[model samples]
Target: MSSIPVGKGIPVDHVVDNTAEHPGERAPLVLNMHEFNDVTTTVCRVAESRRVPMAWYVAFVFSLGLLGFLGFCIAYLFATGVGVWGLNNPVMWAFDITNFVFWVGIGHAGTLISAILFLFRQKWRTGINRFAEAMTIFAVICAGIFPGIHVGRVWVIYWVFPIPNQMEMWPQFRSPLLWDVFAVSTYFTVSLLFWYTGMVPDLATLRDRARGKIRQIGYGLFALGWRGSNRHWHRYERAYLLLAALSTPLVLSVHSVVSFDFAVSQLPGWHTTIFPPYFVAGAIFSGFAMVVTLAVPARELFGLKDLITLRHLDNMNKIILVTGSMVGYAYSIEFFIAWYSGAMYEKFAFLNRAFGQYWWAYFIMVSCNVITPQLFWFKRIRTSIWGMFILSLIVNIGMWFERFVIIVSSLANDFLPTSWDVFIPTWVDIGTMIGSFGLFMTLFLLFCRYLPMIAMAEVKAVMPEADPHHDDHASDAKDEEGGANS
Candidate 1:
């Protein structure tokens, strides 16, 4: 039998007279072209044959229905006015502001995991990073929609932009609203650019792997002639690193600016110094929850169990636990400071949040965000699909209630008892909020169905074979020693 040279081009054939004597030191067999083809074929067959679960279909239908309800809400709001919702004198920022904050907070996790974890060099992030990035972009899209429409004059939303317009009115630099305009817009632009850039390499992979003209053309166009050449990789890597650096600060600042909208105001609950860090923490907490919610199902559906292993899930749960604890700490600190400061307004606002007209919302927030994640301390719980799934859903509920409690409780009981009235959300308010869920899920489902849910190349890059040392001198020495000793 002919032998193949491995390292130094020395060839030897039929080295052992007795075949049994030269029993090869069996290193783990690296996947070759044939194995890759087999694996790909198996994956394609399974993906094609497996029926999408009834639950996804049900969710898709329900989400679409909710999206339709959102459309109806928009129409009603347009036809009648902004007065269809509960916003009124003294409580000017109600449901719209709440929804805006909620969605923005939801958008935070995607960027945090994608950018921050990337910066930190977490190899496991490769499994879910792309999806998280997509989530960030979509969540921002959903987030940007509410604040724009909430202004009542949606057509004139461009007035928020500092472009040279016919009106020649520059948006007030002093206004937190203006800061929000810059912050959110910059965030969306940077995030979209980041997400799109990351997708290019993956899109190219999909394009090459395409079966038909349609997919070839579509993915090719999106991929922008990527060849994965060393030059392209070099440039791409630099650009990604630069973007990550830029985005890191924006992640902290954007939410801080959002918080300024409340904290800058002299209103009791709104005027807290803790709002910036508190808002940022809550955003990250909710964002991570949303990531897990989408990722768990996507991993299962796409047969990415090997790529997104239990280790990844465990890591995500740890993040959830850490961030959830941070949020809980923020909640405690807020309460402590409110009481210790001996400020009556601050005291009243904290009291009202916990035991006021919307005490249920506050309790829900605590139970969902703080109490639920405490279960992650158990390794079995953290790794269990059902446990993570339930916790993620609970986190979503808790986060929503957090926004609700912050917005409604603060507004419902102001300094003037005369002006304090219970602010109930109208049907329009309810519909739009529910519709946002539909919008998010619909986009997410489409992403899962179409996209290469796992970052194939990145995952490969992190695997043992990718390590230069994996099959080098030490491994060779061990193999030779074993062979010689045998």
Candidate 2:
């Protein structure tokens, strides 16, 4: 391993092993300390620049417009009724729940990257964890909107909460629907805490580097008095580790509860034992796809290829392949289980999903989620920016259609012919979903503009300089001490 300098006053021999360079000429994760600091300054300078970049302004404007439209849609829905959404008999949970599940699934990647990877001591996570966690927060916000408004009378939306109301009702504990409410909300709260808590040191870095007092105080307040003191870092590391541990199970539980919303139901296509792990795997797949989809452009826009690195993108693509294959395996198992059980409804539901009126959706899901991702098995595709972006989008599309197939197909023509009806989403359904995209982009754009998308301090911590092995001053002290003390 190559020797590297470490944190302030830390001895050379005490350096961590994680900072060791790869054998046989692997490229460095970062260039040099000056270059690393320059990258940090460049990110902050984007926030401080008096002139907003033209491209960013255009995107932000469009996102804000969509948000306005979303607001209008909600107001109109409240004034009119749920009738605006095209939801009808047997298909009450159409686009609304579909969007809800999709966004929630998108959020899992962030927490998984930040928490699970941290626990495993994956050093590469420092490059993208901040960006991914921010995405998680925004994605959850987008997700929460669907369920909140799907209640129709938006005024009474609070009824979902277990508040002792005028009606004296507690939310049903047995219903997975109720469990979903708790799961998603808990996920959001913890994610937000974890995201913000992780940002403090980076925020202080910005605060210290701020050119103007306005920027200084603004970053300072968010920095929460972080001063890079050894004691402060000690507590910070402990807290961060604790949060990471707590967040892992919380992240896992959110999607598991979401799957239970379907698995607990007696409906043939919906009810299945495999749904928990299946949903969690699919969530991570879609989440990584979304991250790749966002990061490829971001690395270009922010001029951050050195920090984000091709290796990061390559690793993420590998995950996408793994999880996408898991999802496909679940699909096959569902089919086999349906056949093996000899239950007519289950069997019919499985056949109908692949060959019934909604066969197009099922096939689309298969193509997008399963077939397209198989391209990444080739190193050429995984490393290509354009290839990653296009395939990521395709995966996202397929996952959405996967949910559509499950939600609409099963309900549209179930065993009970009397209750069966084809579910069709209205203009509101389409618009609202579009608006959710708008909302997601809006938050992300603002985050990129104002916050350190990469965790600066965390990145520094992993840099070669922070490894005491490279600090000759510290190394000499140890040698001298050994000779003198002996």
Candidate 3:
């Protein structure tokens, strides 16, 4: 196959044709793309197209229903009381805290992919980073809700903050709960800024391509006067780099601090040195799984298979496998530590998790979080889109259960057997949990409809034509065009 010319007016059809001819060849990260403009066109087409996919409408309607249901649940919760939940004497923290931790963990993969991978100069991140970043923001939004409302007295929720008032009330500085307020809020702020900063160049592209006044103004306002000049590019790169570096530590620290909510407790299962790393690993594990969950459907629905190719999915699966292994190891080590500490209470706690009244939840957690991911070791499974998609869903379910097992089990069967009782969730608990998913999907679907899903500028930067010598090829093509015109 002769090298395809890189310059404008050089037809790129042969590039796709040649790629098709060689079926077994290593696939390009951005498949079916030879021209720089193709990346912009392919991505922008989704947002700019007049006719939306029927599936998107179906999904949007479904998501809206769930969002409305979430609103209803919140209204009821606020109107009634915290007693509407399944919170008992032993299990004061049930679905609310469980959902909070689960959503927070869900947001982790976005930062890890956006910040950590960016700092490492991983090019594969380009195809999916926008999705992950959006997910991080939405997931954090969902995560933030539970903490605010979980307290019975929603009116006094401001007490969680360090703000002073006429009464001279101050938040408990040493409390892990208060730390969550700072950590989650800070993480959300940085993630939101990081997400928007990266979208500016792409927003400018949309502004330029807009055929209507509203689109031009809407996209233009957010584009921040991006002119694609050398100075603009330089400043954008510098700011993006700084934000990426800033976001990297938060990926580890945010989740680790979240783990402190449990680890700092003196309860048998909750108190442990391993919770920090263990929680971080599980967060990434579940986070990447969610990216897969969202990516598979979005790519399929939006005709983005060429951009978010199988290689990207496969790479994400490998990360899931690695992190899932770490999670499984953490589970085992928890039990080992319990035995090694020479404490009967700790041993009982570990044993109780595996073989207690809530044994079903633990089994599901292990099976979904631990055993299911092991299937990715097979190349066939991870490479198959549906296989990985299904596995990703299972992994997320297991992660939720993992949080449930950690919180509910530990709290339910504590020191005194007489005080121990099973916590049964009300209809409100189940509805609220499902409603959060609705809220996440609804925000994500709206983003897909309006914003550029793929990072057009970043994707183009990674293309072969972006290489330095590609300009020489363009010069040759230009000379050929000049001769033909003459």
Candidate 4:
């Protein structure tokens, strides 16, 4: 248990022997338990602080206003009917469907960042995984709300599912809408479980550290008596691994199923086989952009620069670039195939998307998603806080426009020329879309204020000092030198 001298060159065998005797010795000899504990304490201290800024209050107020707008829109829609929006005969699925797909696509980035990156052993994810996972859950909640209300009666929305009824009328499994019901519902459930499971250990850390009675009770109950015991850690690790594996496929499949709602149909632009991968890529692309948009500000606001470092931002930016490129590729392929296939309807769909009524929307999408993300190849741009923040916002805007272009342009001009008509969204349509943003921000702000946005324990686990090999390297180097000398 004897400690190594501070400055002297201790024999490599001596260091190794001591490390074997006391596994928690300081670096160069063993793991630095003290440093790990100190880092964890510092993170928790910052996270638990009760001070709220004036900006947070302003944001909360604005969010409430948006929520009020949502309430008004819903009430109007219920009283007046779905006719309040711009859904006409041909363009039956307009802004409502577009918004649903847009939000659902936005939700994909969170799970991809947390689960997919975790599976790849990306240590930087530890910094923002908790926040990203929370974003996934909240975004899904936002996404789920649209489709629920999109079906005029809202009350009859539950009929999409199979329930115990005397009539024995089961939802048609063959319908894409029914598939959407199952896909979105399953995604929400799995994401919530994944998010909550990750939070349990962190909640326990908060519970043990909390001073206030309310915090103690709240965090304690959520922690489920997690004590970081070896037994519990063993089980927790296995469960987490299983959940991540399960979620990865769900992330891909849920959005693919969603895309099927458009792709499986005989609509000129919608019938392409590439829709599944294309939609999933677009979803991840936009989702990552949204994650960056929110995370960059939250990390700065919460003074979490050290925990959510430049490394984490760089990784997220890289994802955005890759996915954006994939989406761009899909767009090009779609156009090429449309022309090469010699399908008159398909050719017209692509040409119409570019030069049609919604030409501006198509250009906005290309510029925002395809062109802007190309900047990420430069390390300086991706790592620069302001550069990334601006790019991320642009990406979100572009992705939204992409959906607008796809849904509106395709439906506005179908097979029959006599039936062709341009679709325009009413103020109510725009209001509700903006209101969903309000809901998402409101929930996010609450999360930042109350919960530990950064996963403290997980971050600590990934720190350099926590690596058993980090210090052992020095000893190993010395051992080789000693062998040479002998």
Would you list the clashing residue pairs of candidate 4? Answer: none
* lDDT values, one for every candidate: 0.77, 0.85, 0.89, 0.81
* Reference-based TM-score of each model: 0.87, 0.92, 0.93, 0.90
- The sequence of per-residue lDDT tens digits that candidate 3 reaches over residues 93-137 is 999999999999999999998999988888779989998999999
Regions of model 3 farther than 4 Å from truth: 1-4, 7-27, 471-486
Candidate 4 lDDT trough over 10 residues, lowest sum: 477-486
Q: At residue 407, what lDDT does model 3 achieve? A: 98
Per-residue lDDT over 304-349 for candidate 2, one digit per residue giving the tens place of the 0 to 100 score: 7767877788889999999999999999999999999999999999
Over 1-486, each residue of candidate 1 has an lDDT whose tens digit, in order, gives 213213321112222111122244422111221123333333333323348767677878888888788888888888888999988776677778888888888888878877887898876677677788888877887788788888888888888888888877788899998999899999999998988888787778778878889888998999899998999889989999999899999999999999999899888888889999989988988888888888787767656665556667777888899989999999999999999989999999999899987888999999999998999999889888899999999998898888878877888788899998888778888888888878888887777666656565665565444445644654344344211111
lDDT of residue 333 for candidate 2: 98
Give candidate 2 regions above 4 Å deviation: 1-27, 32-36, 473-486
lDDT of 4 by residue, 1-486 (tens): 324222222332243222122222322311122355555565676557777767788989999899889889988998898999988988988878888999999889878877888798765677778888888888888888888888888877767889866677888999898898999999999999988898888889889889999999999999999999989889988999999999999999999999999998999999999999999999999988988998888777766665665656777888899999999999999999999999999999999999888889999999998998999999889888899999999999999998888888999899999999988889999999999888888888888887878777776666444545555564443322111010
| Candidate 3, residue 426: how far the Cα is off, in Å | 0.6
RMSD (Cα, Å) of model 2: 5.8
The TM-score obtained by model 2 is 0.92
The Cα RMSD in angstroms, rounded to one decimal, for candidate 3 relative to the true structure is: 5.4
